[model samples]
Structures are given as C-alpha cells and as structure tokens.
Target: MATSISFVGLSCFLLSLCLVCSLKEGYAFEELIESYAESYLTHTFEVSSLFASSICNHSTKANERESTFRVVDKYGPCFQPSLHRSVVPPSLTDIIRSDRARIYSIQARLSKNSGRRDLIVEPNSLGIPIIDGSAFDTLSYLVKVGLGTPKKDLSLILDTGSRLTWTQCEPCRSCYKQSEPLYDRDDSNSYVTIPRNDPVCEYVRRPVDPPRPINLCSYEISYGDGSVSVGFFSKETLTMSAAEKINSFLFGCGTDNKGPFNLVAGILGLNQEDASIVFQTAQKYNKIFSYCLPSSTSSTGHLTFGSQTPAPAGIKYTKLVAEKSPFYGLDLIGIGLGGTKLNIPESIFTTPGTIIDSGAVFSYLPPVAYMTFRDKFRVAMSAYPLIPGPTAAIETCYDFSKSTSVTVPEISFFFKDGTIVGIPGKYSFIEYNTTLTCLGFQDGGDKHSIIGNKVQRTMEVVYDVPGQRVGFAPNGCS
Candidate 1:
C-alpha cells in the first residue's frame, strides 16, 4: 500500500536546519534567501522582495557575478523533508509506480509522429488533440525565479525537454490547485500585454463561432500526461538575482490548466527553442549552462548559465546529436556491466537514440538492452541474497537489511567517440538505509531509451548549445 507524507512536518524539519545554517560562520546570506524562497513556495509564506534583494546584495562577491539559480529536487530534503531518518523510508513501491507512469506518458507522446510546426501559427494550425492521462504525478526538479515588477518569486519546474515557460495567472477561467497563489497581472508594474495590433498577436486564434482573431497573444500547450495549459502570451520583467533582470520577457499566463503539476507555480523551459528561457538569455550568458544533480534527495543542487571558470578536470565530452525531438540526444554506443560489455545490437539504440532528460526520475533502455543488462547484473550480484521477485514497477529487488555492505558491480555508459562514463555501485542502487536497495534502471520499450535523472546524479552535466557538445564530470552533488 502507498502512503502520503505531510508537507507541514517536512517544512518544519527543513526550517529548523535553515535557521541554524543562517547563524553559521561560513553560511552566506544567499543561502538564507534560498531557504526563505523554498519556504515561501512550499508553505505560502510572505517573503518580501526587498528582503531577498538585501540578502543577495550582501552575499554578492566581486569576482563571482553571473546569472545563476538554485535547483532543488522535488523530493529533496530541502523541498520535502523526511520525518525520521532511521524509520522505514517512504514506500519504494509508490516511488517506482510514479516513475513508471512518467515513462509511459513520455513514450506515448513520443509515439505520435507529430512533425515540427511553426513556432507562430494559428491556434489550430496544428490539430488540437486530446492526450490520454497515464503518468500524472512524476517527481521533477524545481527552480525559484522572479517575475513581474516588485519581483514575485515563483517556484517553477525545471524542464529541459520543454520550450515554453508558463504560470497560472489571476482571472483564471479554470485552474488546478497549487501551493502558492496565482500571479496577479494587476500587481505587476512591468507587466505588458501583447496588443492585438502587434504582429505576434496575429498568430493567436480564439475558439469561437467564427474563430475570431485574439486581441492578446494566446497559446495552448498540452503535455504527455494529459495536462493542458491555455492562456495569453505576454511580457514581463524577469528577475534572476539581485543584479540580473531581463525586460520584456515572453511567457505564457495560463488562464486554464489541469494535471499533476505538483506544487509548482509553472514550468521553466530550458530547451533549445528560440523562445526558451535558456536561448533568450544565451547571449547574456555566452550560451553555456551546467547543472549538478545531487545523488541523494536530501542535498540541494545548482544550475548556472554562462561559463564556469577552471572547468572541472578529466571531463568527458560527447557531441550532441541533432534530433527533431526537443531533447538532448546522444549516440549510445554500448552499455557495460562491471567490466564485461553486453553483446547487444547497436540497431536498437538508433531509431529513438538516447535522450538525457533531467526531468525523468528513472533511466530507461531498450527492452533487449534492459534484459541483457539485468541478467548480467543479476549474475554479478549472485553472492547477495535475493529478497523478492517483484515490487510494483520494479522487477528485481534485494534484501540487504541483514548485511552491513553489499558489493554491486559498476555500470558503464559507453557513448560515441569512445567516451565512457562509469557508474559506481552507490549510484546504480537506490539505498533505503542500510537494508533495501533496488536497481535504478528500467525497461523503456523497444523504440526509445532515456538517461533519466537518477543515473545522472552526482555528475556535472554541461550543455554547451552553441558549442554543440555536452560534457560530464564527476562531482559530489549529494
């Protein structure tokens, strides 16, 4: 059976830590701002922009001035605190179920051969189709970004596979429940609605008897999970840090929305689209970005735009393959278990290639590859006692409760150009204390394979869009 955890208990736990850290010597004021931002988003606390700005100004270093944002995992301790560390952790069955649902939802969306459409077009230029709901409550990483005049801080899901940044606005025709209040346009002094006379508004169409033209720039976006967001596209001032702010930022003001958006205010798109937040600010940051996802849910990660000085040593580099899909695709040459390479056909990885998505929780591989890898892994772990055959979405699980340490073989991801990245045992297995651990990989059907966030943890993933390459380096993210 699945059980839900309370946010109140979690917030209190995190709040206590934040308070203690604020008084520490090495702790900077920015950490306090981040903690306050998390509390405001999760508990609806009233955090003033002036306070946030003051904290940022105090923490700003002379040489370290750049546009950067703090990224927190949705299930991280800072975001969702655990009641007790020694107590049995949240149900792995529940976590696996949610992860599988997300995978299925993504697969369904990819199955559709919807060709690329023009960015600006009639509302129905691309057929409006209904999506089936399967994976609704998937965990995602969140980032705090400020928008509007007085800088209303909003917690948005950080998505590398999406292109549009959006949030629910006031005067919503219909909207789903969210932890924070809907953004009120009237309160923003820098808010500017796209006028009907603007060329951009011509592409917007309204649903009516005659399909009349919309006076405001409108947009409708549908997700793989059957959730849809529809509203006018407008411009507002976007604030990143105390010193960084962008004017006339294009974003969707969702008036009607639905689905398991979780507790976030909206989605922040990081795809390579022209209108994406990353692209819009690329020039300012020199088209460079990197993120280090923590291995454990208790640690907080960071996402930075622009250059990272003195790049981490011994970084593995791979060319970013160009694909029609709005994801970062790479040629997966092979996968290795321990020191032995699996004799799987390379053709299985061609059709859909492999996508490295930060939003996905589980790594998915072609069925053949998955089975081969699983069999090899099982053989490698023959020494350990097998606990169970199946548990929800996970087929293989083990009981390490009686043992102090388990020796699991290393899993390696072989990419093109002879670039090999190995995964340590700690990363390959999901440890629920000293007892329970499960394989982090899953079967992603025969069509597509995805390198989910789980496998990408503790690695500094650098997406150099302009350079057309992605680099990976080991980092202690947890």
Candidate 2:
C-alpha cells in the first residue's frame, strides 16, 4: 500500500513546481480520494466575479489554478483563462516555428520505433487535408454560428476567434457548404441575441486580420494559429431541447475571407462556465450538456448541444479544479505511480514539468518514471512474459498480460489540499518493441514520452479554468 507525500501549495505556486500535498483530518483518507463531480453555471454566482470570485472560489475548492476563470456577472462564464495565462516558456512563438524543422528530423526515428495495441484505430480521419501545424483532429468537425432563422444540421467548427454565432442565411453563402450547417435560430424557437459590443463580446473577441471594413454592429478576430473568424455582434436564440433554451449569444454572419473550411462552416464554442449558451441554458433549466468523442480513427465524433452524454454507470466522476484563466488543466500536485512517491528519483521531479493536456494526444511520462514503472510492472506480470501488447493503448507498448485488472497498482495524484486521488488499475501496459509483431500502435517519441488520449480517457479530468486547477480521477467528465 502507498501513502501520500507533500509538495508545494497555491498562490505561492511559482516555485518551479506549482503545488504540494497536505492531507486533512484523520479520516482513513477515504482509502482513496472519493470520486464525484459538480457543475454550476455562471449565473450560479455573480457576473461581477467572473475571473475573481467564481473562479477564485472554485480554485480554492479544488486547490489549483489550472481550470478556473472569471466572467462578468453582467455577462457569463464561458472560457477558463487560467489555462491560457502568461506562463511563457522559450515562447510558443519559437516552439511553433521550430516544429516543421523538428518534424523532418524525427520522422524516420518515429517510424522506426512503432509498437502494438489492443484498441482499434479510426479510419475516416486518415489523410484528411489539414492546414500546416494542425495536429490530429484539430481541424475536424467545424461548426458555424448563426442568428435568426438560418441553416440547420450543418457541420461547423467551434472557433475561439469570432464572437457572433450566426450561420449562413437561407439559400446558403455563395462559398462552400460547411461540413456542418448552422442551427436555424427561428426553427428551434429558443434563440436570443445579446447586444452588439457588450462586455461578453469584448472578452471573447479574437481580432481578425485584414479587417473587414463594415458594421451592422460587428467585430473581427484573427488567431495566433493564422486562421480568422469574423461576424456581426448580435443576440440569438438557442433551442437546445423541447424544455431547455436560452436567447442570448454573440455571433456573426458575413463574408469570411478564410475561404470555406472543407467540412467546416463555423465554430461552436462549447466554452462557458456560467454563461455561454450551454451553461446559461443549463442554468435557466437546471440541466447539463454533453459531448461524445469516439475512439475510432475512421469514424466521426458527436458533440451534442443538450443532455449529458450517457456515460458508463460505474465510471466514477470527479469535480474539476477551477482557475482564473481561459484554459483548462489537471488539478494535480503530482502523480506517483504504484504507490511509490520517490519511485521517480529526485532527478525527474526537479525537471521543468510533466503536464496533462487534453489538447495533447498523449501522456508524457519522464524516462526515470517510465523505467521505474516499467520494471515494477514487469515483475508484477512475471506470469505472462510473452503476452500481446495493446498497440495504441500505451505511449510505450507492452504485452505482459498479467490480467490488466489484477495487477492494478495504486496510481495516485498529489493535490494541493493534502488529498491524493488514487487511480486504480493500469490503464495500460509498458512494452519494449516497435515491430508489427509488437502490435497496431503509435511509436513513442524521444523527448520523455506521452500517455496520449487512450490513457487520458480513463481519467475524469476536472478542468476548472478560472481556478487554475485540474482534478484527476479514474473516470472522464460528463
């Protein structure tokens, strides 16, 4: 059995590492951190405390700054900013630039080190035309916004650039038909638009390049990623369900120079802590929204507008760590695998970072941790030495079939509040091969490593942006 260790704490989180662990009470520590989840819309709090109170309070609850954000009580809580703050590292400007050069160098190495997997690979997403720098499905399933009576059932991207939520007018835009069309505001009969240039608009606005010279109450936005989104500011009704709905949102409808995105029309921002269509609507009717992501590489995912996506009943849920920013992250003080805090050796803990990012497809375990875990895992699995590997299951492949469920180790996360969330079961095995005989999987990368989505899917990631915290457990969120 493994016990918890302490690290650092919040506010004073700038010390190389951002957190520490400190257990409270003498309550048997719950044997394991109890898994649970709670979601409240911004209206749940006051708008005046968007980044301050709502976000701060949430951060205080979960104890990290990775997931909370403040939204004006006057508007709503939609984006978590803590995840998008001023933590500069050699400048992303530089990292983005160096990617192309680095890719050419790592291609051969990556190909030569492939492995095996137990999961099935998706096929529909293969060979899709992606803009440079677009990794994975970053460019998939675009959704366009619209106000009034517009289009319906169209595929669109939920962009962070534009503020308006308008789709193509009747008869559609002369450009290309988006992969998905805009929702007809009039048809659902629940759409409502906010005023032009409201406080919410100012916060969500992403300025566009080659600014369009026009206005019927509008704005423009450009992205650091080189893409652009533009539209007139206005309120729109959202007919989520027969009983749930909201009539307020910022959106645009006009000529976008960023010529039709193939299979994409606009962007549906599922962002909002208290306000956005989903949260606001949820607040008004006491409901929750859910989206589903398919693990298949060949099929498409579904991002539904209303109702919580049905989840496996036994999968435990965890409350997300809220923070004061525009992004979401894990609420982790630290992670100790196999109940061993010092298993990784001081050399790795002192290193810069080991983060959990949903945007990133894999988990990055340090070499020290990987090796330590790999060896112990092997010893535990001494029963099945020549077992089959789960090709895409782990960043590193392994097949020692010691009954994945049987050899489940006590993997734990150190939280700022002295609480540890111990994850049960080895989400995957550690393998040592790159041959086809190894299995159907991705080859591990050189710099440290990534655990990827496969493992991430096993944990319920509570990304409370305004609070700057990330809560992790053995299940995914609703």
Candidate 3:
C-alpha cells in the first residue's frame, strides 16, 4: 500500500512539474519542481487518489486530466482558501502638492460648520448648493476594486476617515470627469436595487419629488472637504478577485456626484461604519484589515482583509477610543522632543484628541501644542542655518547643502497607556529638494488634531476592529 501510494504521488508530482514548466514560461525549472514536491507532500493523500483516478482514464482522455491538474496546481489557496487580498495602487505624487490646500480647506470647513452642522441639513434645502470655491484636491491612496457580474474595474480612493463606499453609476443627472468608463447597471447580471424598507436603505435621507415609489432607495452624503454624492443605495456582486466574490454587497451608486475626485471613479470607504465595505464584509473578513503605506510615491502598497495572525513581532497596541465615529481616534497624552518631554497642557491634547487618518498628508496639533513643539524644535536646531521652504506652505525649513548629514532631535508621541511612538528625524523632516528639508507637522488650529499619512509611512498599521484596538509595528515603508 505504501509503495502504491508513493508511486501515485511521484507520478502525479512529475506530471504537474512538467505541465507547470511548459505553461509557466518564465519560472525556474528547479524552483517549480521543488514547489510541486512540497505541494505533493502537503496534499499527499488527495494527490495520490487523484493521480490514480486520472491514470486509469489517461489512455481515453489525457487532456481532461492534465487540465484538471493544471487548475488544481495554479491556485493553492483555492483548495483551502484563507484571507482575501487586495492590491492598493500608488496614487499620483503630484497629488502631494495639494496636501496643504486640503488641510486649509478642512480647517476652514471645521471653523464654519462646527460640530454636527454639516449633518443637520433641512429637507427643503437639499438642492441648494453651498458652493465654496475650496478645491477638494488632496493626496489620496487608490485601490482598484472589481464590482458587479463580469467585473467592472473601478479605481477608488481608499479612505479610512469616511464611510459609505460609492461609485458613479449610469443614468447620471450630473457627474465629474473620470478616467475609466462609468459602471452601467445594464451590463451587470447580478445588479439589484435595494428595497426602501431594508435597514440599509435608512442612510438615504433626500425627500423625493412627490414621493417616488418606495422600492428604489436613495442616499446623499456630504464630505467635510465640500464633496457631495447623491444617488441610489443598491446591492450588487462585489468581486475582490477571481477567487473572492461577494453577493448582496451594498454600495452607493452615485447619480449626482461632484468632488475634487481627480480622474478616479469613486471612494472605497474602510471606516468603522455599518455601511462601509469593511463592516459589510465583516463575516468573511473578521473585521480585520491592515496597510503599510510606502514612504516613496514610486513604490506600491497592499490592503489586506481578514486574518491578523501573520503580523510581525514587537507590535505596540493601543485602545481605539470611541470618541470619533468612522475615524479611528487614539488617546494622545503628550509630545516629546528627543529625550525631554514637552510641557504642553494635557487638556490641549485630550480636548480634540488625535485622529489617525490616511486621507490627510501632514500631522496636525492644536495651536498651543504646535507652537510649543515648533519653539522646542527650533531651539534644538539653533546651530543649523535656516532656508526658505521649497513651497510657500511649509514654514520651517533648513539648508542641508553643505553638510554631509543634518542632526535633528527625535519627536515622540506619548499615549495614554504609557506607550511612546518615536518619530526619527528623517521622517519628521521631509526632503523638499536636493538642499532643503521641511518640517512635516502643521498647526491644526484649536478644534481638530490629526496624525496624517506622512507620519504613518513605513509602519504596519493594523486596524483590528473585532479586537477593538489598533496595533503599530515598524515595517520600513520609508
């Protein structure tokens, strides 16, 4: 029996090895053989039986057995599927130029709108456009998500700060310029309009003219950066890849959408909201997701869902405070310069707290905290000569032309759990040009404080919603 099983497994392995070598043109022969040998041992019993069955019928139909083996060998995870993987492509670096502008716009909006002001819009005032010439152009990370049957690929901005994933659909009353073709419901076989009675349809608040039929649910969402999307709330087949296909996935099909959306199709919301893609696919993914934002714009990063066990060692964990809805909030207690702790008031840090956002570029602090940090930073680097920033937006810059290397103090963030996250000088001071380096921190006024994407670079930030905490580990993304 042992001899028979060994023969079967060996025969199957050799056949698969030869087939893979012929089909996979670029793969090394030795590597392929080694991989198949490992696979054969892992699925030994199944492969032995499968090979015996195939060999028995090989004389009559050899092609069928070869094809079956090919499919089995190609997708190892398909046989025993695990976590869903999605690739987030890098965004245009020129979008980095719009970072300061986005910060200004957000600050202005927060100043005028205050708390819950943007959410409390009257039903009659729905159509009235509040036009602020503030451009919504901001540095964004993008991911290509396949939706609907037959899979229409859409480029969406990956935002952790917002909820409700939306895309511009056909039958557009008004729309913005998109690089890709708009998603047409007619082309999708699995498309379904969500019934108004469904609990998911409650997100739609716009009063229809003369009250249209309750069968079609509608939605309206306004962004803090002055971008608004109003359209139908519906469910369709959402495909992450060829292997992963989600049915009855609810998403906003924007009919009237306007924003500084650039050439992208829509937004992929990964926030802590019921309507978000992360929450909708919680059962499949276990409410776990993580990302490592690359330091350079040239390199790409990954967005993974489900399974957080493979994380690297020495990850610092902190509780995700429930103060901010949708946005992930962390309790920031104090700021430290080198080894010395800054004497800024605890109230300043606690009042607004610190929100970790992937959408924003620069880290922001309250006015008092910012001034204290800036003053201390300046004093620490008093010996170095100052230079004009590459852009008007960056105020603090230094001349690094003559020196081989510039010595700058490390800035650390003190959290409530007595954990300190230290930022190296290289990360805190960004190289604007060949000879100039500018400070990455900005004053967020008094109302809001944010830890932006620039600060998060090269770090493995794990958002473990099921565990109700966020974990961070050094990943060399920079």
Clashing pairs in 3: 458-477
Q: Over 4 Å off in model 3, which ranges?
A: 1-136, 207-214, 381-384, 389-393, 399-407, 430-436, 476-478
lDDT score, candidate 3: 0.63
Candidate 1 lDDT (Cα, 0 to 1): 0.66
Reference-based lDDT, residue 182, model 1: 82
Candidate 1 per-residue lDDT over residues 167-186, each given as its tens digit:
99988888887766688898
- How do the residues 384-431 of candidate 3 rate in per-residue lDDT, one tens digit apiece? 777766445566777666665556676788888877776655567554
Per-candidate Cα lDDT values, in order, are 0.66, 0.34, 0.63
Return the top candidate by TM-score.
1
TM per candidate comes to 0.75, 0.47, 0.70
TM-score of 2: 0.47
lDDT ranking of the models: 1, 3, 2
The clash count for each model shown is 0, 132, 1
Error of 2 at 40 (Å): 37
